[model samples]
Target: LGVRNLIQGLGEALPFADDTFDRVTMGYALRHVADLHALFAEYRRVLKPGGEVLLLEITRPERALPRALLKFYMKGVVPAVTRLFRHSSEAQELMRYYWDTIEQCVPPSTILAAMAEAGLHQAQRRIVLGIFSEYCGAEAGTDR
Candidate 1:
């Protein structure tokens, strides 16, 4: 884990010049963004041609049973287990927030469209258990 230049910046208004990085990744924060389109566009602007953007998010399942099961696991089991490992209730609150965001987040199609509109091509979403999702996109005009 010898990573250099670990920097933090606002998603909506990235403090970087054009084509600065080869790749960008957003994890579990897309739901918190006010404008998905704008955030995607910003990601594109900072990425070099052929660069990739990866987004990791929790998504709502299509089926009712999976949804109910996920809710039970996240809201009930996860928090309860977290309470055992950590003394603070903040972990439980964080889990609740994650579940709420996943429950209320926009559809995966919308996110893909935003990536495409932001000049990213080959955008695709891989969903696991109808819950965890990995959204990946490459910059347009790239042979990658």
Candidate 2:
């Protein structure tokens, strides 16, 4: 309900009442949340019956060709660009490490199953690209 409110008072712990929200959107915020399941649980707690959760995210490519391209970009192009930013190869390496860890660490199914465990009724995923996906789900007892 407060998607556009822009209120500064709410903490990482949301201020809204339980079961008050209809749509929970975390657009690419997954990169920062340390405990993924806790975030999903909080979303589950706040969303009303039939409420939906939408997550837009960047994922490692699953296809071989795309994966190879991504490796090239990650290992080559991104580092080249980063060098322009700070004249620091370590910065580029750090940035590369970030994406590398993201690819090695996060799992799409783990995320979806966490939603299901949180009582989201219908959880599904749509791959937007070889390197990205959108996870959409609804609260338990909700109609499609």
Candidate 3:
């Protein structure tokens, strides 16, 4: 499939009115933002009292070998992929910094704490692909 429904958006701010949406979905979109906490705050603000947000994310694996392999793959192979698509070294560098898809910058616990601080009632982190994560969260006031 080709890319479709491409959107221009600010990572830290969304355009929707508060408490309007039932759910917000993100695929590997939170970590690269300059302030993830603020983004979560916005998610909380826009969602209804019982609404939820589902996020697809990559996380550093707990095991040693898998973690090492993921880091190596991200650092070594990702740049090549960026070149294949972007065809520019500067773009590649930007991609490497913001879109490299590695999970090393922040730890798992920090993510959980952020959800809690963002007023999310129940937040869960599940790792898939042995190197990525799926996070689902709910608003604090009501069950959804």
Across 19-117, the per-residue lDDT of candidate 1 in tens digits comes to 888899988888888898889889988899888999999888989998999899989999999999996699889988878988889899999999999
Q: For residues 27-119, could you state the per-residue lDDT of candidate 2 as single tens digits?
A: 765766667777777787788887899988888777788888888888788888999988997898887886776567467888888778867
Clash pairs (backbone) in predicted model 1: none
What is the TM-score ranking, best to worst? Answer: 1, 2, 3
Candidate 2 has what TM-score? 0.75
Cα lDDT, model 2, residue 134:
90
**Candidate 2, number of clashes:** 0
Number of the top TM-score candidate: 1
- lDDT (Cα, tens digit) per residue for candidate 3, span 114-137: 877888768888877886777888
Clashes of each: 0, 0, 0
Native-referenced Cα lDDT, model 1: 0.88
Instruction: State how far residue 64 of model 3 sits from its true place (Å).
Output: 2.6
Candidate 2 clashing pairs, residues 3+ apart or interchain: none
Candidate 1, residue 73: how far the Cα is off, in Å: 0.9
Better of 2 and 3 by TM-score: 2
In candidate 2, stretches whose alpha carbon ends up further than 4 angstroms from where it belongs are 1-12, 85-94, 141-144
How close is every model to the real structure, measured as TM-score?
A: 0.88, 0.75, 0.73
